[model samples]
Target chain A: MNKIFETPLYPYRRAPEQDEERIMRHKVVVVGAGPIGLAAAIDLARNDIPVLVIDDNDKVSFGSRAICFAKRPLEILDRLGAGDAMVEKGVEWELGRVFFGEREVYRFNLLPEAGHKRPAFINLQQYYFEEFLVRRLRELEAEGRPVEIRGRNKLAAIGAHEDHVTLEIDTPEGPYNLETEWLIAADGAGSPTRRMMGLDFVGKVFEDNFLIADVIMQADFPTERWFWFDPPFNRGQSALLHKQPDNVWRIDFQLGWDIDREHELKPENIDRRLRAMLGEDIRYELEWSSIYTFQCRRMETFRKGRVIFAGDSAHQVSPFGARGANSGLQDTDNLVWKLRLVIEGNAPESLLDSYDFERILAADENILNSTRSTDFITPKSEISRILRDAVLDLSAEHEFARPLVNSGRLSVPAVYDGSPLNTADALDGPAISRPGAPCPDAPLGEGFLLERLGDRFILLTIDADAPDEIEEDGITVTRLALSVRDDTTGALKRRYLGDEPSAVYLIRPDQHVAARRPSWNENLFRAAIRRATGKE
Target chain B: MTDLILTPNLDNADDFYATLLAAHEGLTKKESDALHARLILILANHIGDNKLLEQAIEAARKAG
Candidate 1:
């Protein structure tokens, strides 16, 4: 029997009356309980910053949405203690094949190089992703970290101030007022919080529509991404098929702009389309179906005084590239650390400005890539279609044209090339893992390099010894030395040291490289730290 | 590498040009433009090197 996912409703509890003598104030209050908000809550709670998360709904996501989890998000999740469960429940895949009309045009491997800690990508339902994060949050709460989750509570109104923000929340019984020092608005795409604040998401909305369906079947298809452009099965349109956990598959059929959504979603029509794509003999059961048109847009500013936006509330993109949830998780990953420092009085509020700058750049990158993919998949004019078809026809015979085939350019980690927090590159090191980039993971001793960093600044040394301890201001610097261990297999040297005998890398609490030099100096290290914390 | 191929490479250049023109015959202006766009993409894909493609694009943009 195929297992069907059911969203369990949480019972609502009455809030304390507004006339109470004193109301509880939290350091951070996250507005949504989706993947992004929950990740931020978990990060803040893990850092011992008390967080309260309020959600209008109680259950997990309803359908199989946002199935692709990229490596960078996985790394971030691992830091939050939920990575192993997701990897265990997900179908890991890296190979993708693109076809034009029945002929195989090109194939690509996402992670051709090996020795990384995480896989290239994993395919799992969005509900399971949120459930795993909620589980991790409960584990942290059990350990006496002040992380509270209140469901069935909606944010009715919001007022921002220079010092804090006041929120009016409506519960099942009545309404109550709450105040928080920092507000993380992670409420999803149609964010009520964003609407309440009168902020607009500005960008382009593609005219094309896509039909997404989740079906459960026992078939022997290879566990890889298969995308067809104008295939015989679906005439003159595009189709994508991906394997997920529990013998379920996700199929997307691109319908033109003039589709009758209601008529297309009928059971008989869906069955006919599935039959045409998967053949009559393959007996399958439908799990879910939806019609969607996506927009590649973002808010003008991610940080607005005391009210900060993350995830879909701040930016949105088409689902073609699997960048939506992955980038949202990254937004929270980039945000929580800065918020924690600012809340702890260790870093100035100016540090949060860097978060806005860096993530806006990242959002722009995702939007640009997503727009290109949308344009390629659904050509607006005859000229565009002609060029797209020519590229497809030539890709089968040539390797160079394969890169131009953008069947959703899969998500990759964004490098902050000109981030204000990045220190100048004074050392000759591997360009692949540079300042402002996430530190590449390699085996160190019995653990991984990423496992040794984060939660505090790290001064990582490869093939060299550093001082026993370095602590300045409120930042605790942990010194880690990695040499040619049996498990390393020269990965550490290749990734960090390059040709140098010894090198020092300064990594931030978010595991982003802050600076690097051939040799370590206390004054220079302090200067880099000052710059990273916005002291300079 | 120099992108200019001054040497004669095609064996039947006259026939190839005739066929190319024939492919455009009887097409409207919009259709001809679409065909030209497709031909450009196909030929660029055939010449896979990006540096060479850049040089070719610059050379084509320059007026004689």
Candidate 2:
């Protein structure tokens, strides 16, 4: 028996004039029940904000889409209370193997950073990730802050006003109207919401198609990422194998400049190709497969009028380094905290643009880095092949060269610069503060580290000498023991900020080191908080 | 320049290890530093012990 979440989708669409019987307007309407949308809804609803999420799909599909979840997304999920379930079901890849043809050029373990407390990366099916988020949404509904998930409710049109957004939704019952205080357009790469507003999605699209298939195999392959450049199965095609949760393994083959896409996707043709790639001796069962074209595009502006873009709706990138979904989710983390402020009436409309400016920068950085990685892996020219081969050959002998073989630099955290939210004081001078970047995770006693400094202003004071006072109304000050100095001081210097004499760093909830100064001067700290939260 | 012709063969673990080490020799100083961040996790995967993993990370950081 299938369990469907029952909600009054039809009755909730009563006309505005029928005041007595009309349904309450949602504070936020999130279109698309994908992982990012569901995550956005869960985060907001958990904070006691009313949210309504609509999707065209009726039920979750059992297929692989986004397979990689980096360390940062795990932390975001951990805060929303969905980390435990995901950790239980997801496959963790501690090691990766880079191959130069059949020869393994590099093999290294993804040791979790020494001071931090989480695995480097985990692999789970995209749909399962969405399902887990929906389940969390359901739990939030049980509490006072309810999230209404309207499945099969397609969005027909959107009318964004100065204060609210009017949505015309088409469901099985009929056409219904929904008025929301805020409209989140997470409808994906080809977004209708983005189209309605006439926003430009601009970037270069790569002329390449990747064939991906999930197969169950009886083989003694170790738990590691296996990548092959120019494998024997297909000429000018790269082969990739990633182990999914359970016994299923995802294999991706890059089709060359010209090939029959229609013919290659047929089950018998795909099976024959898989057998040819694996060899006649290998026994495997094909589960599913699909073809995807790579695109490196981002919106000219993430926000236009009252509508805002999230996830792939805002940016799209090649999957070589697995930055597409991970970066989109990071955008969600940045935008949600700001929206919370706006809906609660703490910030003005100008604060909303920070979400666009900061995330667009992040999107650009992530896509460019990922695209460079893809180019390096699948080089087209003879010169590029020689350069790539030379690096791989040398990486086999030197510890220094080994790191470049797999190109793990693509996974580094993004720093938000050039935004009104980022003050010059955040980056300047010799200060003991979390400035301009995520404050490196510090260890507290009893295995409980301060992972989240909260979504608003978090003031960390190391000096207990000045009577430990940071009584700003909205800012939270957590006093740490002398031991935090060991990690915080080292991290600050590494980030080029040098030592902190005053012994305090105020960190913004987006995890950027906002101000690295001593015991917060009441007026200065309050002003900075006002600026950061857009209260100014 | 003639490119190295090495086929992708998982059965030859010795070849795999040797090839990886050779690739490590090619990185510039700054590039090597960035790459070291991800190497600890890969090394830990090979060893299969969390404590050893921590030790490897600490040792790598200390040596660097």
Candidate 3:
């Protein structure tokens, strides 16, 4: 049963502010309650910033739109108190097989190592992901945090004033006026807020159409990603099959550039294709189906005055590599801390320009990868098609050709290289854990290093001397001392220390490496704290 | 930047040309194009250096 979509999780209710005449002002107002919007709201509310989220619909999204959740976003969710629930209800897989015709040519393991807390990727329905975020928001509400989600509240109009944003919200009762010091637009690809502000994105629109069908069956296919190129079932096209929780499988078929979508979406036609794929004897139920065309594009800048855009509203990409939603979660992960600091007067308003620099680079990288994948998969030109078929043919017998095969590059966290906020690297540490890189998770005695790091600016000293705490301006930087003996696996030494015996790292609140050195120096730490917080 | 290698690199010119032509026997024009595509890709990958391959591409386009 598709219970998640049919039920109204956040039904419309009459709020007291609707009856009042004066406009209600909030610390932050978030538009749309999708995964990105909810994440931003939860992060802000958890940090004691009052936030209100509004959405037109009252339930989790209609269908399972996005199904792949990568690890870095999962780590971000964990920081927001919703990670374990998602991992528990999700299907984790690292094995993926790429098939040419009927033979499997390329097999890949996304994560080949151990000693990490989360898997490389997980397959879970978007509805479950949204539900988990809403549940976490409810838990925070129970803890008396100032957060609210108003269903059937549509942001009909928006205007940016000098230091705030004004909104005219349409509700079940009627239209009400609201104002917020800062506005976050987490609306989806067709963002009304963006349209209201006379903003548009410059990008490439792919002509290909992809039909996605979520089917329920008791088939015995192993829990792995299987991609087919020029298979007998769908000749001259590509298909993808992935397993989700509770015997639901996501099957995506490329329908080329020109086709009657109505004819293709017919029940009998869909059934015929499914039968051809799963043999004639298997019986299954169609849970959901959709036809989508994607574009790789983004706004010139994510922030405009007091209004900031996040998620698909700010950037959009094709779903082949599952870059759409994964990058959306990362947007909010990079945003909330800066918003919090700005709201509390801890950091200057210019601190948000770093968000634009970092996330836009990530969006460009995602667009580049997904566009390449789309070109390889679709091959719009005859010459492109020939080259693609060549790679597929050679991959059957050649090990070198396997890497040339492009099913999808998949999603990985973008390392913010040359970010303005990062201090100069003082230690020749591991390249993977350098300045502006996310802190790699290392196993502590009973937990993980990231868990101990939490959401704060920290001075991490390994086998080195450091003060207990240091405060710069209004922000506090605490020290977490560790030894090589803490981790028996030597991941701590290998990932952080490398050949250096002693090391010190200044970690940002977003868990990015702001600076690092061989050992702690009082003057360097003070200057670094200033630079990392935008006081310099 | 270095120019494309214009001189002959293969040892057996006649034998290799014969083998290349024979591989396309009994194939249609589309099939022949596919063979050329595969051949070019395999040979290009064997060279592995992107700069050299780009130079080769430039030479071929210029010749056309």
Candidate 4:
């Protein structure tokens, strides 16, 4: 058998006991060096904030987990300076085909429109993602940024206080204590931190089990998502196939709840199933396989005092929609900027409340969608199965029925429609780029719109004169004007200005639209800035 | 949207009608009615537009 990909392990270094006794405290301590934890650490370090990341494991990840990367997370990774490498190493796909029985019922293109910087989704092993993020962290550290990652270290206890949080960590050398002004718990689904805090998840636990297998083979399958409902090979069950890099194929089999896991994972049983799915002519090696039953649950509150929860530690969803890791990355994206400002004493601590509000909304949306998809895929009752089949049958001939066929509605960035940070739409040109939406990427002068908007407040003026620089209260405004020279194909005008002649947009550091107006006034812009920063 | 047309929409309408009648040939009246009810639900789910399905329901009731 060909050798499977494995993450390189780092040795655990002993820490001096005096280091823990030092009066100096770290700005942020992130528990778990998974993708979400590493991403959080990098985001903070990029903002010139030092962060310490601890994990119980020394390697990146055990197997090919969390294989789907949505465009929104890619854009967030781009901000962290690791987006291009991920995209280049992953398989880019935008089309998906849904099959019922023996026939193809529906096909959808995620990105039918153009002028976007990244594709709709990419498929890469989770280990590769963590490895790339660790590399980027090392690069940032070489450039004088503080990002310390300590492997083989586990959090034993957590104490949250009014001013800071104290942590007891068990390392290879010995156990020690550390202090941090803020704590981010990205410790994944079985989060020990959450358990130590005596908090329980509140939501639904699905009964259906799924077997995910990563097979290394040279197959001639297209790089599009293929979903099967009651496929012939897997009778009365659903299956999914996705192509990952390194010639690895991820296949998911919907195994009903009543099966012996050990028996199902036996080599002979797995080989028989694989032979049934792939013809005898195709030879392959199984790289990894695991069984999982997911739950759609979240903590009651993501933020409690000085400790905050991001990723699976705060929320979890079924893997149907690939919402698990993507939503977690967005949490880090929304959090690190607010945490940075709060740590620097530029913004009040109340700004962190918005993180909970916004991410809770996103988590709810993901759970809702994931639950619906699961229900459709595995109907609990006979009546629902009939209805699901009816919808699938009609989707082949009718346009209206296509939307009803839910084969895992792929992950899309959550739009913060009712966020308190948004300045109400007193003036609006296009509803697509309205308040609380992620700023749409467009072509600028020899670059992208997102590339120009740095980690600071931006006043983007379209078809109007750019304003002079304004810096106040630790907030500096960088202005850019969109002209014919900047947008040659008029993608920017079409996206930002539907029909209006001129418009001014206030964008937060995280690239979400804070407010927009047809005309620019210093007072209105400043007021929106203040509201976004939690000063209002 | 309220109008219903019983035209030759299928390529082999006569053959389909024959098959439809033959499908109920061996069934009792109660069984036939149950099959018709199931067929109605299946088609209604396919034509997912609630407004159009409601219009069709009203038309079927009026015809009955």
Question: Which candidate wins on DockQ?
Answer: 3
Docking class of 3: medium
Provide DockQ values for all models, in the order shown: 0.43, 0.03, 0.75, 0.12
lDDT at position B45, candidate 4: 68
What TM-score fits each model? 0.92, 0.80, 0.95, 0.90
- The regions of model 1 sitting more than 4 angstroms off are A1-5, A17-21, A106-111, A205-207, A485-487, B1-52, B58-64
lDDT of each: 0.85, 0.70, 0.90, 0.84
Best by TM-score: 3
- Model 4 lDDT tens row, B1-64: 5544445568898999999899899899756665564566567766767788877778778888
- Interface RMSD for candidate 2 relative to the native interface: 8.3
Per-residue lDDT tens digits for candidate 1, residues A128-242, read 8988988899899999998988888899999999999999999877788889999999999898989999998877565567899999886787888899998887777899999
Q: Tell me what TM-score chain A of model 2 achieves.
A: 0.88
Model 2 chain A worst lDDT window (10 residues): A1-10
* Model 2 TM-score (2 dp): 0.80
At residue A275, what lDDT does model 1 achieve?
86
Question: Which one wins on lDDT?
Answer: 3
Instruction: Itemize residue pairs with steric clashes in candidate 4.
Output: none
Give the TM-score (0 to 1) of chain B in model 3.
0.85
A345-384: candidate 3 lDDT, tens digit per residue: 9999999998999999999999999888888887879999
lDDT per residue, candidate 4, A335-393, as tens digits? Answer: 99899888898899999999999999999999999989989998888668777787787
For model 2 the local lDDT of residue A460 reads: 61
Segments of candidate 2 deviating more than 4 angstroms: A1-24, A205-207, A397-400, A406-410, A425-434, A464-502, B1-64
CAPRI-wise, candidate 1 is: acceptable
Query: Candidate 2 residues A1-536, lDDT tens each?
Result: 11222232223333332343464567888998877888899988887788888887655544678888877787778777787788888998777777666677778776676655556668887866777887788888877676778777788988878888888887766777778888888888888888877786787655568888988888866778877766667665678888987678899888865778899899988887888777778878777788877688898888876788998888888887778778877888888878887777667778888888888888888777877777777676765665566666666665655655544344555776556675556334443233456555544443434454655556665532432435444444544334335544254343323444544556676667655554546666667667676666
